[model samples]
Structure formats: structure tokens, C-alpha cells
Target chain A: MKLGDPRKAYRIAQGAKVRLNEDDAADMSLCPEGGKNSTQGLFDSLRDRIQTLQKVLYAENKRRVLVIIQAMDTGGKDGCVKHVFSRVDPQGVNVKAFKKPTEDELAHDFLWRVHPHVPGNGEIVIFNRSHYEDIIAVRVKKLLPESVWKKRYQHVLDFERMLAEEGTTIVKLFLHISKDEQKRRLEKRLENPAKHWKFHVDDLADRKRWHDFTGAYEDLIERTSTDYAPWFVIPADRKWYRNLCVAKLFADTLEDLELNFPERDFDPSSIRIDD
Target chain B: MKLGDPRKAYRIAQGAKVRLNEDDAADMSLCPEGGKNSTQGLFDSLRDRIQTLQKVLYAENKRRVLVIIQAMDTGGKDGCVKHVFSRVDPQGVNVKAFKKPTEDELAHDFLWRVHPHVPGNGEIVIFNRSHYEDIIAVRVKKLLPESVWKKRYQHVLDFERMLAEEGTTIVKLFLHISKDEQKRRLEKRLENPAKHWKFHVDDLADRKRWHDFTGAYEDLIERTSTDYAPWFVIPADRKWYRNLCVAKLFADTLEDLELNFPERDFDPSSIRIDD
Candidate 1:
């Protein structure tokens, strides 16, 4: 099964206006004729390829990869990562899930905590939810005035631009799931005894303001997506397809680096082992 | 196969004298009678158990675990972590490797950079090298005066004591290997083309000053090991045995927590989802 180019299919073009409501949450247009069943083999291969590429990246030790994933509740952000990068070495890949800021974190500049977590040389760092929360959640919940949250779009762009210029490759993904699909997922969580710990009452409050959240995402993606750091709107309503697309997107991004293991400086043939 | 109690065998007694040269790097006293070959199944089970307990810890969202690993070059710090915690969820476990202090890091207090990376609630953090370096490396290399490095021991104790009082569990491990074993590992790295990237000429300088490093370690461990945050010295010449001991130590620590999935405050049966 041939996977379509995720860069072309999903990436939000720079300066393009985005409409979340108009986008298909269950789009499988990029999937091959065999659809989800046949794509499992491709997905597995992509994960293996990603693992191999990550090793080369780690060995190269000159560049970094930053993956930012944003999603509404039950949009499969966690599931997508679990399926896609499951094969990568945990030592090289770090997942940072940004929760509500503590008093100490809130006292600092918005990017202060985030700057410390950026990928060092030869590392892949994934931001599960990121500084965008300061813009999106704050805007929708009125935690900050429009004038305050409005400046963050430029601040984020500047921050990402600096990261990119400093040899960091950036990929931002928005797990796009429909409101109806979220309701189905929420209901499933409520029905399962084991999953109740994951179901929070506050999630219901976010669900009630779906349009506001979507609008916030649309604005953030439109304003933030750039040539340096592109935003990909992943159709996440279908679990299998979402995983496949994410795997392919990540593999494609890493391959573009043309990574290679570092050449040995000393002659290995001349070295002797006394053991 | 009965694995001996690691806590009883390896943990340094508070206020006790320590001698690095007296410890056996290849000691298998903790290993079961059946030895390395028999411990594979046990190792696999411990990894699984750690994974399960970590989930409960994440769900409980009350306590934190901090694992500190210290070792000489090629003493199997990375290898031990890879084998022991391979099954842990990457989302919950964070490994921070401290390399040479950067200009910015040197400008701040020793613990300032480390303060931000401590485990958050429901998280497990592993420090590949830690604030101990500020003492061990500084004293051994003569980077700081005796008076300056000596005071840091008290600072670290105060820092860790506060973390313990605030519901963070601390476990520190030092991987002990002999000079002959270090020579073998360094030679192996030079002999293998694939491992040449892991080798450095500076490692030889450290090896030449092995006595200095070990002496610093002895003094630091003797002074710093306390009831709140104790240190364990693992025999590490045998890779399999080192992994087994570390795995058992971690699993035993988590079991002491008696972790359970948190109960939902909202009644699951009463909660309804409109689909």
C-alpha cells in the first residue's frame, strides 16, 4: 500500500486561512486502495524506519528534532504517539506533557519552562501539549485579556524560528477529531470501569465550549504555521489511519535530514582488545 | 532462583565508612544459585511489574520517584537503565543526563539547573549523573577548592531532604567497576567500529586518575548517604548481574509504595454520556 505524502496532504500552508469546521476529521484520502488493513504493514515498516533513523540522528549528534502535538480531549494525541514511535529508543526520545502551570512556572515568562525542555544535540523531544496552551486555553477561558494573549502568536513564532535556526527540525501536529467522535470516545471511557480514572469532569466543561476551542486552534495554526515550523492537521477520528499518517509523517521528516552515523576518527583496525 | 535482598546487601548505612577498593565489582552474591542464565525470566517479570506499578503511580498522582545513577566512564550506567526500565512508559519516565556544565550552567548555583528537572507529581525521573558530579568531579579534578566542594555536600543533603519531606522518594545507585574492568571496556569500545563514537581520549585521563575519582566517591558516599535518600553501590563488572540488581532495587522501591489505581470521586455508574 502506498502512503501519500503527508507534507503535501496535511501541512497547513504558510499564510493560508484555516477552517477546522470545514476540514474532514475522518479523512482517509491519503490511504492507499487497500485502506486500513493493508496499511498496518506499512505502519510497522515506517516505525522501524523511524527507529533506525533516530539512531543515526543520535549518532550524528549535530541536529535535533522537536515534535509538538496538540489536540482536543479524546483526539488521540497519546494514542498516536504510542503507536507511531513505539519502536524508537526511549533514551533518545523524550515526551514532555505540559500540564497546568504551577505557581512557580506561571511566575516566569511563558517560554522559560519550555526552553529548558527543548531537544539537546542528537535528541528527539516531543511536546504533548505546549506553549500554545497559553494562547488557546487562556483565550477561550478568558484567563488573560485579548491584548495579552494576542502577542503570544508572534512570541511563539519568534521562539520557534530561533529553535529552527539553531539546527532544530520542528514538526507540529494538530490531532483533528470531530465533536461527535469525541462524544463517542467520552462515552466509551464512562462505560469502562478501568478507564474511569482517565475521565475527568473538567473535560466535560471543555466539551461544552467546542466551537470556542476549535476557533482558537484555527487561529493559532493559521498564525503560527510557517516555512520553518509547519503545522499538520492530522485526521484523528479513525485510529488506524491516524497512527499510519503520523508514523509516515515522522519518518518522512527524519529522512529529510539525510542522517548518517558519525565516521570514526581513529583507525578501528589498529585498535587491540586485551580481553 | 531466589534473588537476595538488594536493599540489605547494597545500600550504604547512614554515617558508615565506605571503601571503594573493598567492594567486589564482579560480586554475584546477590544473584540466585542458577546465575545469569536463570535470571532472564525474573528480569522480564520485574520490568513488567515496574511498568504496572508506574501506571498506578501515575494514576495516584500524589508521590514522585527519583532514581540517581552514578558511574565512571563505561561503567554501564546507560546499559543498566536500558535493560531495567525498558518496559516503562516513556510519558512518565524522564532520564536527564548531565554532561559538562555549559557557560550558562556554570554561572548559576550548582543545584539551580537541577532544580527544574526534578520529578513532578506521578513522574519517575532518572539522573544519569547528578549534583554529585559537582563534588566528585570537582574534587578529583581540583576544579574547586576543598572548602568550596566540601560545603556542597551539605547543600545537596538539604535539597534532597526537602524533596523527601515533600513526598518524593529517592534512590541513588553507584555502579562500581574495577580498574581492570574499565581497561577491558575502553579497549572494547576502541576495537569496535560501531562503538568508536562512544569513546573519547579524555576517558584515558580519567582512568589515569582512577584512584582520585574513587577516593572522592568514597568520601562523598560516606558523608551523603542518609535515611531519607540513601545510596546503593552495585557490583557492575557483569552486565547481566548489574541489570538484575538495578531492576530488583527499583521494583522493590515501588512495591514499598503499595501503589493502587486512584478511585474516581465522581460515580462512574451514574455518569451518563450523550452520544
Candidate 2:
């Protein structure tokens, strides 16, 4: 087996897991193992930026955040949600992961199911898997008509526009991972008994349609990346790099909003009381 | 001044703030403060309970939580949201404060302004001030006629019942502060420069009808407390005690739900491969 070249189309003739320990995985350049911590500075800067933005955001009560993550299987969505938002004030943030619709949910329009979950003013809402799934997974699984899936593009754009108009700032990310990397992750789940619970046989069916999902994503990004909600295509082949990219983007988005506390009229004499 | 007896009705004169830092303030005969601290422990346990519930609720695709906080002015609604839920995983909670409605919001049904912000399943949604104001503040301010405000009592019950039917566990709290204590807080706000921003002339206007507000609250508790969502009247003369009561109720509610992670099958060889 040979290490795939980043310059060209990397191909794996045999489907096998790539064993990456923390030490070995430190080589993220897609070259020979040159041991260096490349992600530390990116994460540190992100943490600081988030804190400052948070103070402003909580006080301002003017803006809202809606983070939409679209990814292939095992693209580190959970890990990103945990580590990136670890220090944020829980009171002002929310995470919503859209899964297969329940009976009551299926009775409504697709957007109806998700609308209630969007953050209000002075909030940050994360959609772990979002409306894109209707276009990506449901389309791949043929769960909906080609016409229904195709029409959702316009519906999604309109929905996002409404949110943006109403003070919700949207940041969408597509986590791009190579087929080989995904296979390796799927295998690791089988090896660790503790993690074996996370592996689902149904997930492989989704894995088989990888290219189709990517094509759907590429189209979704191209079409839905509007002035209000732009999509960031992150290279998620390296988990550390992926987390770093997301953290920076998340931090940058909040900072760009210029959140701050409203000005208060002060009366200094009010604090002193002669008993 | 002689301490008033806890056994009878004590006159709380107009504009006079009660000082309860003495023996009278320590009257916890019916339900002692020690028991309340244990309830505080129960509330602290909610953080862990919510974490476990998340895995199941996210997988099950149920996203809904509605937390209602109702109290007298300066009853620690903001503080409860900040302190009780401080340790919640930031990714799963949303907080909304409902102040006086804007012209647009007033044009719609009372619940209409609130429906959009309900928590998606696996997400905890909090209302710092809720739809109950349709009756309480509106009634006290003479903003609505008796016919309208009285009708709202039944409307609120139906509204909350609908939420519970949709799988939201409603936890309602009324921070019960004595009138004398309210005056002291108002004076403190007036005397402190930093605190001056919190006090407004309108607050004094609300205090003028304090008895009327109390009567409205008594009626509300009697009519609204049901099996689906029980109301807890927290003795809130002490801020720390108020937080403790709310925290205990919150923790006990989630723990009662008995949340647990779903078991998954493990296969070791399926996940491991070498380069």
C-alpha cells in the first residue's frame, strides 16, 4: 500500500481502515510523518475569539447564529460540537440534530420541523444534521421523489432568507472527507468494544452512496451559498484541521457581527446611602 | 422596630422595604431551608440527567423543552436561568426573555409570539418571562379588560396542555418575595450607581398595585397547577434560596424522566485494519 498523493486523485484499490494514533495522526500534511502540532494555535485563537464574541452577544441581544453542518458518515460532527463550544455559556447556545422524521413531524412541511429549533435573538443554534439531509440522504435513498428533492433547493433558500431577514446569521459547513478516511473510521468503531455501540450496519448503505452524496452537497453549496448564509467547504480528511477550520469560522462569524452591550445611563450617586 | 410575628398578617407599609436579615427572616417552619438545600442537590443532578437524555432524544428525533419562570418583579428569573442551567451542555439549551410585546407581536395571538421559540426535542427551551404575562402584568396594568384577562386563564391552561401533549415537560416557578423585601431591593438599586440602571420609575408604578398582583398570582397558581406541569412557589426573599429551589425542581423533573443510552452491538474485527 502506498500513501496517496494530495496533488493527484488519491485512490485506494482495497477498502481498509487507516490506523491513525494521536502520535501518527499528527502528520496531517498527507506526506511522510513530520511530527508537529499544527492545530494548537488555530484552536487557541478560536477559543479567545469565541469568549469575546459571547460577552458581546449576550449583552447586545440583537443577533442570532444558525450553524448548519453537512457531512458524510463519521465526519466528526459530534466532536466538533463538544470541543468547539466547550467554554461557551450554555444559556445562550443550542444544538439541534435533525434525524428521520417522526409520525407527527412527517405530517408537516420539512422546514416546519426545523423552524422551531432555530435560535432566537442573542442565541447560537447548531444544526448537527440539517435540511440538507432531505436533499442529500433522502435523495440518495430515494425516500422522496426526484421532483420533491429538487424543489427543496428553492424552499431551503427561501427559508434561509427569512431567517437572515429576521436577525439569524447562518454559517453552513460541508465536511469533505475521502472515502478511505471514512472506511478507516467505520472500522475503528468495530474494533473498540466500548465504541462498537456507535457503529450501525445501516450506515454502510449511506457510505455506498458517497459520491452521489458529495455531488448533492457540491450542488447544494453552489446553489444555497447566498449573501446571507454562505457555505464553507472544509477539508475534513484531517479531523484536527477540520475542527480548527470550524472553530475559526464559528469564532469569525460571531466577531463579524460586532456584538456589544447596549449603552446604559448611569447615576453614580444611586450607589451611596447615608443610614 | 419590633420584629413582626410569622403567625399573623404583618403590615408592609407603602414604600417601606422590609429587612429580613434577622430572626423573623429565618422562619422556615413549614418547609425549612435545609430541605430546600436537598432540593438544590436534586436540581444540580439535572445536568447529568440531561446529558444522558440527549443521546436518546437526539437518536429518537424528539426535540422539545419548555421551561417557564414566573415571579414578582426582581424575583430572580434572569438569575435562575443563569445559575441553575450554568452547567448545561451549551449545545442543547435555548433561552427566551418575553418583555412587553412590540406592536407587531401585540397584533397576534398571545401564544403566537411564543410558538416560534419552543425547544426542539433533545433541546431544553427556557422562557425567562412567558405567556402568563397576558394575565398578570396586563391585568395589573389595566392593559386588558377583566373579560379578556379572565378568559386568558383558561386559554393559558389549554396552551400549556398542548405543549405537554407535544412532549414538553413544563417546569414553572414563582419566586415568592415579600413586599417589604421588594422595597429594600428597590432602595438598593436606587442607592447604587451600577445598580441605578436596573431601577426604573415604572417599577414603582407596578409596586403600587402589588396586592392586586398578589391576588392575580394566587388565582393563577390554583387554576394552572396540573399533573403535566406542577407549579412550585419558591420563597424568594433570599436570592440563593430561590436559585436552589428552581435548580432542585429542574433536576428532579429530568431524573423522573429516567433517561438512558441505547445499547449497541459490538464487532471488533470489523473496525480494525493496518496500513
Candidate 3:
């Protein structure tokens, strides 16, 4: 199969019912031949394509792209963003990691803090964690009531629709990892002193409530997967496959923009630079 | 008359045709009971009220206020922002000056740069020069064709409407200074070595196109002013009156929100700290 051909298998269809447990988190059916070792070359090529496309997007200076990565703790959001976008120009791409809301942020509507960070023209913005948290984390943690969280599904849809109409192409990715894989990763973090800071005790608390989170995620994906902003579920148990899929998804999405260098508005041959 | 009562006199009615030359740049009909020397106390009081209201705004943290100031070159945008908001807490009030567009900024839609600097919840953001520049400056300089800049009127209206519906209180001020006043200000800048840095030869180029800019401003204000985002033409020749008017405008705007410190989410009375 071609590198980008399997993307549809991972994308949750608009209006389709989603069951997180039904999807195989470790599935590598789309992996290229010689799986792990040979994947590096493919990943590098995709990264190079992303870099070239991003430069053209910058040169064209018109369209915007927003990439949102959502994953459970240890599901590799940071790792995925780092590996996939490492070769892209830092100036053209902005990565915003949404942490716990500040006192000021909690006071406004959830979308208030988010609106300012959307991409400008000729830019790509990556949300490490995003507005989806207002739905998923709020529901799972009972941060707000059912009514409040339930209403946000529509709010998110309306907001994303508006953004799409305003010339932003949005892609959301949910990294899927099995519960056993999460446990193994947690163990690996604990085993190494170098990774100790990465192992948060609160992550264990989140793991305990895994089923609640999964239910919330499933509901959100089903509700918010629209034509403008679709959700992709990447099987992330294998780090290499996850990276490859994400890189390919970005490359394919940017290529679809059909971006090219903007035509020079002036006749370059008639101009002379005086020293 | 009360400090804020005459604000309506300066506000351009929605859908009203504007003639910049007809408005008195030195008019002080809305100025306080006293002239410039005796106006210090009232201005101080207004500043104090602004500071107080800003604190409550910070504490409440639910609404946003955006102040957009537009003017010709040497029209005192910086001075007005500095004097009017001097007493307010810097943390709660953000002032963003939109200068010339970088190559990256020129690549996208006109509103792209402006959207990112808008006020957050409980924040009061001042745009030293704003999106109006896209209409006024672009037209005066013939940077883009009439077909391009003319469409921006509707774009701005729609964009501001969205912001207003999303809970931002919008106040746009056109610091209305006479052409003569601008010439005087420019001369004053050139006379003082300390102020020479503020004067630029390019400003003379803009001054030469004064009639073009005035005409453009009239058309934009006539077309784009809405009930949600009204434009107030401040008589800006008298620096003291201008500052007083702006201070009163802000204080009155924040007061209308009826902001109060949020009630404690957790009861302090129920818990005691262990020493």
C-alpha cells in the first residue's frame, strides 16, 4: 500500500459511531515492508516533504493549517510532534501545549483562551493538547457538570466550523495505545532515573480512570468528526508506526492544499539594486 | 456635565455618514466644567476609577474589552494609551502596537495579525493602531486596489460581530486631529533632538496624502461602525481633553460590565490552615 493510502482507515468518519475498544491499538497492517528498521527512510522523506510544503505555504502566505494531537498520558503526544515535525522550519510552525487551566482561564468560556492561538496566514500551529480537553478531561474528571460538558460538543462543532470557513484547515489526531502498553511505558519510565520526571504520579490516577476517559473520547470523536476537521485515530502502541502515520497524514494534508510560491507582483527583470 | 455623559456626542451613530473635516479636532464640548489647567482633578478621578474597575475585571475574569485607536501620523495614539491607562494594572491591560506589516504578515488575510492580539477574558487590550489601518492606509497608499480594500469593510464587520458575540466589549477610537495640528506636531518633533527619533521623512509622505486618508477614514467609519463595535471620534488637538475623554470612556465601559470579584469556589470559613 502507498504511504498515505491507509489514512482513511484511521480517520473516524463524520456521523459514524465510534468505539475506542474496537480499534486495535497495536495494529500494524499499514506498516511498510521491513517494519521498524526500514521505516526511518520513509519517515525522513515525509518530513522533508512537510518541510518543503511548509516553505511554500509560507511563501504563498495565504492558507492556514492547524494540527491538534490528543492522547492519553504516555500515549506519546510530545514524542509524536517532536519526531514528525523536527525537520520543519521552526518559524513556520508553532507548537502550543495546553496545560492545566490558570485561574484566569477558568473564568472565561473555554474557547476564549483558544481563539487567540489559532494560526495566521501561511502558518501551521500544532496543539499538543487542545480544546478537546474541555470535553474529554472535563467529563472524565467531573471538572464540570454533565450539562456543561455536553453543551461543549456543539460549541466545539460551531467554533471549528467558523474556523474552517475563515480559511483554516484543521486536523485532529488521537493516538491510541492499549492499556497494557500504557502500563509497560509507565514501568519503563519508573525503571530509568533519566525518565523519572516524565513519570508523574498523577498519570497513575488518570490510568485508573482509563475507561471513563475512553468513553469520553469516544463520545467526542463521534460528535465532532466533521468534514472540515476530521479526527484520525493512529495506532500508537508501536512508536515507529505512529510517527510514520502522523508524518504521512501531515504530508498528505499539506499536499492537498496545492500550495506553491506566490507569483511576484512586480516585474523583477526591470528592477535594479543601487549600492 | 458628568465625565462620561457626553461620550455619545463623540460616538458616530451606526450607519451615519462621516465627514472628517466637519468634526472639530479641537472641540471640547464634552470636556469637563473646567478648562485644561483645572481639568487635572477630574482626569485623575477617572484614572482612579479605571484602575479600580480594572482590578475587578481581573478578579472577575469573565469578559474581555478591546480598545482600538486609529489616527493619522502624529495623532497621539501612544500618548493617549500611556496617559489614559497609566494607573491601571499592567498585568490586566495589554497594549499592542501594530506597525508595518512584515513579509509574513502581508501573506495572510488582513485580520490575521489583529486577531491574535485581541483581549482575553478579564483583560483590556489596547490596539495602538489597528485593523482600520488595513482600510485607511491601504487606500491612502494605494497598496491594494479599491476592489481589495473595499471588501475589507464587510470582513471587519463580520469579524468584530463574532468577537462581540463571543463576549468582547469593543470600543474603537479615531483620534480626530486637524491637519494643521499634525503639521504642528511634526514640526515640534523635528525641533527637539530628543523627539527627532519619533519624526520620520516617510511621515511627510503620508501627510502629503492627507486628503486621501481623510476620505478613506470617512468611508470606513461610515460603513464599518456597528452598535456592537462603535467608533468614537475623539477631538484630539487638546492633549488634556483627549486624555480625559479616553480615561472616561474606558472607566465607563468597564463599569457597564458591573464586574465584581468572583465568589470563592471553596469556602475559606470552613477550613483552617495548620500552623
> What digit string (tens of lDDT, one per residue) describes model 2 on residues B1-275?
12112212222332333332223332344445455555555445555555555545444445466788887777677767777765655556667788889999999888899888877666678888889998888887889889988888788888888989988877776677777777788777766544554666677667778778887877777777776766666667777556654554565566566654446654455434432
Model 3: residues >4 Å from true position, as ranges? A1-4, B1-275
Model 2 over residues A1-275: C-alpha lDDT tens digits?
12223212211112222221223222344423432274466477777688668756876767888998877879878777876775566666777777788889878888888987888777888999998887887787888899888999999989999999988898887666777787888887776554555677878777777667766766667777777877765667677666766776677677778765655554545432222
A37: Cα error in model 2, Å: 9.4
Q: Model 1: how far is A88 from its true place, Å?
A: 3.4
Q: Rate the local accuracy (lDDT) of all candidates.
A: 0.89, 0.68, 0.82
Best-to-worst lDDT order:
1, 3, 2
CAPRI grade of model 2:
incorrect
User: What's the TM-score of every candidate structure?
Assistant: 0.91, 0.70, 0.53
Which regions of candidate 1 deviate over 4 angstroms? A21-23, A29-44, A102-109, A263-275, B21-23, B33-37
The top-ranked prediction according to DockQ is 1
Instruction: Name the weakest run of 10 consecutive residues (lDDT summed) in model 3 chain A.
Output: A266-275
Worst 10 residues of 1 chain B by lDDT: B266-275
In model 2, the runs with Cα more than 4 Å from the true position are A1-52, A100-120, A138-168, A184-201, A222-228, A235-244, A265-275, B1-50, B53-65, B102-123, B154-168, B178-201, B237-241, B262-275
Proportion of native contacts present in model 1: 0.40
lDDT, residue B107, model 3: 100
Q: Residue A159 CA error for candidate 1 (Å)?
A: 2.5
Task: List model 1 lDDT by residue over A140-161, tens digit each.
Answer: 9999889999999999999999
Give per-residue CA lDDT, model 3, range B1-275, as digits (tens). Answer: 35545467888999898988735989887654668877888888988898788877866779999999998888889778767875554446666778799999999999999898898788888888988888888888889999999899999999999999999999999999998888778777656544544655677778778888888889999998899999999989989888988888878888899887665433323422221
Cα lDDT for residue B88, candidate 1: 75
